[model samples]
Target: MLLMHSQVKAKTPPTGLMSNTEQDQQFQVLVEQHKGILYKVAKTYCQDESERQDLIQEIMIQLWQAFPRYNPQYKISTWVYRIAINVAISFFRKYQRRKSSVDLSDPPMYITEPENVEKEAQLQLLEQFIHELRDIDKALMLLYLEDRSQAEIAEILGLSLSNVSTKVGRIKEQLKRRFSNHKI
Candidate 1:
C-alpha cells in the first residue's frame, strides 16, 4: 500500500494569506498524496514518454494554482481528478494541434522490459485500446478501472449518476468486444 508523505511544518501565515513557503509545503503534501492519480491521467492521455512527462508537470502546475480555492466539502481525490482530467484533456488537445505536422511513424522504444512479459503485453494492449477511446470515455474508463464508486465517478466527471452508469456500461461493452476481437 502506498502511503502519503508526512506533512511538513511551516510557520502559520496570517489568516487568508499563506506565505510562499507555507503554500509550497501544503501543495507538496497534496501532490504527494495524489501523485499516482496525476501519473495515471497523464499516461492515459499521452502515449509518448516525453509528452506524458509534460502533461504530469502541467497537471501539477494547475493543481498548485487551484489548491488555494479548493473546497474541503468535496473529497480531495474528486477535486484532484477533476483538475487533472481537465489539464490532461487540454494538454492533449494542444499537443495534437502542435504535432499535426510532425511525422509520428516511428514509435518510441521502452528501455526497461517488464519481468512478466505476458502481463506487460496485456497491459500494453489495454492501453492501446484506451487511447483509441473518446476523451470523455477515456476519463470515465480510467475512473472506473480504479474501482471508484459510480457516484464518485459522476461527481468527479460532472455527470449525472444515471449518465455515468449508462456510459460505464457502454464503455465496458466496447472494451469487451475489442478484447474478444483482438487476441491479446
Candidate 2:
C-alpha cells in the first residue's frame, strides 16, 4: 500500500453549466452504472466494512469533484478506474500512517456475498495474504482482476509492458508460495 501515485475524459464538459436537475440525473446514472465496479475494487483494497465504506464514499466524492475536469480523450471506464485506484491507494497510505499493519485476528467483520461464497474461507485467507503485498503488486493485481490486458494495465499504471508482465509473474509466484506456506 505504498505506491507513491497518482480517468476517462468526460465526453462533454457541460460548458453552459448543467442545471441541478440534469446534474443530479447524470450523477444518479453514473452511480448506478459504476457502483459495482467501485465496490469490487474497494473490497479488494480493504478488508474491513468500515474502511470499505469510507473508501468508496471518498472515491465517489472525488469522482464527482473530478467530473468537470474530465477530458474527453479516453473511455469513462478508464477514468473511473483511475479515480477508484487512486482513492484506494490514498486510503491505504492514510491507514498505514495511522497504523501500519492490520490485524487479521479481529474476526471476519466484513463478509459480502462473494462471487464464490463456498470458497469464502480461502478467499479471506488469500485476502489477508494479498494485503501483505507491496503497493505496486496490489495495484497490478487489481488491474488484473478488472481484466485489463497487460498493455492496458501498463498504460494505466505507467509501467513498461515488460515490467508489468514480469511483476505480475513474480506476484503470482509470491501468491503461490504464501498460500502453500500459510498457516490458515
Candidate 3:
C-alpha cells in the first residue's frame, strides 16, 4: 500500500480537517498507495525487520496525528517525508542510547533470516558499510533512494548546491573504498 505523498507538491495546504471516518478512509487509501516510500524510509533508519516494522507503525501513527492539521497546500510527499525523517532520526538515536540491555529486551529483538543467501550477504555488508558513513553521506543516500533532485535535496536538507556536490563526490569515493576493502 502507498500513501498520497507522491510528488504532488502543494502551494497551499488543504484547509479543512477530515472527519474521523473520512480520515480513516483517506489513511487507508494512502497506505494502499504509498507503502513503498514508507518501507524504504524505514529501512534506511533501521538495521533489522522488527525495527523497520516498528518504524512503519510509528509513521502510520504520526500520519494519523498530523492528518487533522495536515496543510494539504504543500506536497503530501514532502510533508510526510519531513515527519518520517524526524521520527527515524529520533528513534534511531534513542535506540542507540538504550545500549540494548538483554533484560529489558524481547527474545526476538532481532531477526536474522535473509530470505535468500545472496540477499543476506549483501544486506550484511551494506548495513556495515552504511553504518560507517558520515551523517551527511547517510542523508545523501536517503535522498538518492527517494529519487529527489539535487535542488530538492538541497531544499530538504538545507545544504548549498556546491556543498552537496562536494559531499556527494566524497561519499562516492568513500563508498568505493568501502566496497573494495571488503572490511567495515
lDDT (C-alpha, whole model) for all candidates: 0.76, 0.69, 0.63
The ten-residue window of minimal lDDT in model 3 covers 98-107
lDDT per residue, candidate 3, 1-184, as tens digits?
1234444533233335445665576666666566666766766777675666666777767776876677765566666666777677664443543322212112342445556666667666776676566655776777765687777677667789988778777776877787778745
lDDT of 1 by residue, 1-184 (tens): 1112432211221125657776676777777777789888888888886666667777777787787777666777888899999998874444453322212222455635567676667778888999999999999999999999999999998899999999999989998888878875
Better of 1 and 3 by lDDT: 1
Clashing pairs in 1: none
Error of 1 at 80 (Å): 0.7
What is candidate 1's TM-score against the reference? Answer: 0.78
* lDDT of each residue in 3-99, candidate 2, tens digit only: 1111222355422466766665666566667777688767777777766666777777788888767655655666777888878877444453332
Query: Cα RMSD (Å) per model?
Result: 6.5, 8.3, 6.5
- Model 2 residue runs over 4 Å out of place are 1-17, 91-118
Best by lDDT: 1
